[model samples]
Target: MSSLWEYANPLKFMRTTDWLLPIVAVAAVVVTTTGLIWGFFFTPDDFRQGSTVKIVFLHVPAALMAINAWLMMLVASLVWLIRRHHVSALAARAAAPVGAVMTVIGLITGAVWGQPMWGTWWAWDPRLTSFLILFLFYLGYIAMWSAIDDPDTGADLTAVLCLVGSVFAVLSRYAANFWNQGLHQGASLSVAPGTRMDWAYKAPLYTCMVGFGLIFLALVLTGTRTEIRARRMKALAARERMA
Candidate 1:
């Protein structure tokens, strides 16, 4: 934690992350491309859902990240709240757009897939409704960040907002328990041993997921760097004014 805190300064962050971004960027592109090819061509059509099921390659990972990104922000927000770490606040802010993007992807893909299978593009089903609220919450959080003026004020406000948002993530899970009506089936890719593996499908799905994860990392790092620079400019301007 102390080591992380030491790199909170903009200069430190820029210096440390400078060399790594390009490497990650290239890897992300390659992985995503490979995944798409494998998913679209190599993976066999599902026996039950047919070709539309390929959307799972996109939908599942985005949905997983949508929820996990908030959890990441929640942890960063907690760090900021408890220890007053500016980088933690900046990181929480940085994560907002990525999470929002993931949520949007999940919503759109889910709708597209749902229409053909369920005969409706939308549903009041618990899983669908809960995920929708998650999307809305992402919008609201980003809106709040944009609305505020001062960085510290924005960070504090958004930190509180992120904290509030974390509670609702439960909807992602509780949607199943509360309503007992869900459009989504239970997980097909279970981790338990002896779980059936169709190598062709699993190969592409895992590749896409890895690719998406890399892309997400790249986005978060870039966003954090931007926030750090913006803060520095603000500080320098204030110092000039004071001097």
Candidate 2:
């Protein structure tokens, strides 16, 4: 447990991720390409939705990452607040943009899917509404971090914001279940006895999910490394001025 905190050192974290980043990047490219190609070309179209179902290949994974990214940030925030870990705070900072991009992808793909299926581009349904709220939270988190000049103060404020925003993020995830009447469908991937998706779609969908997860990991690592370097540069500049 004590050893784990050693990674909170920025220089150590940068050195470790240097090798890791390229591996993750290559894996992300290969897996994402394979999954998207397989899902798009090989998978059978849905009898009900037809080719529009192909959009699911992008939507589901993005939505999953969108929610999971916030969860990751929330956990990182807690770690920073409790342990005063610089790496944890920077990790939370690094994850925000990736999460925001994922949220945008989810929202846009969902709108595309909705237009064909629900006959409207946008709906005020509980699921959609909550997701929008989640996006707003992401925006607010990013903005809060940028608004403050002091790194420590920014970290503290954003960590608290991340904590508070987590409640809404949980609510967003369960909104579909809570409001069954919403136009949005239920879980597409489940391990339950009776699953809605067939293996034909499920296989590639899972693959894409894995691919997106890897992509998220790669992006976070790269962003965290960049943040570390920027902080180091800032510290050096401060010292030079003091001299």
Q: Which candidate is the best by lDDT?
A: 2
Q: Could you tell me the C-alpha RMSD of candidate 1 in Å?
A: 2.0
* Candidate 1 regions with alpha-carbon error over 4 angstroms: 177-179, 193-197
Please, what are the lDDT tens digits per residue for candidate 2 over residues 38-93?
Answer: 99999888999999988999999999999999999999999999989989999999
Q: Residue 192's C-alpha lDDT in candidate 2?
A: 90
Candidate 2 clashes between residue pairs 3 or more apart in a chain or in different chains: none
Worst 10 residues of 2 by lDDT: 1-10
Q: Candidates' lDDT values, in order?
A: 0.83, 0.91
Measured against the true structure, the TM-scores of the candidates, in listed sequence, are: 0.92, 0.97
State the lDDT of candidate 1 residue by residue for 1-243, as single tens digits. Answer: 457777767677788779988898889999989998889877788887799978988998788788888888999888888888888888888888998899899889988998989888888887777778887888888898889988878888888888777876777746676766667665557788876658778888889889888888888889999988888898999999999
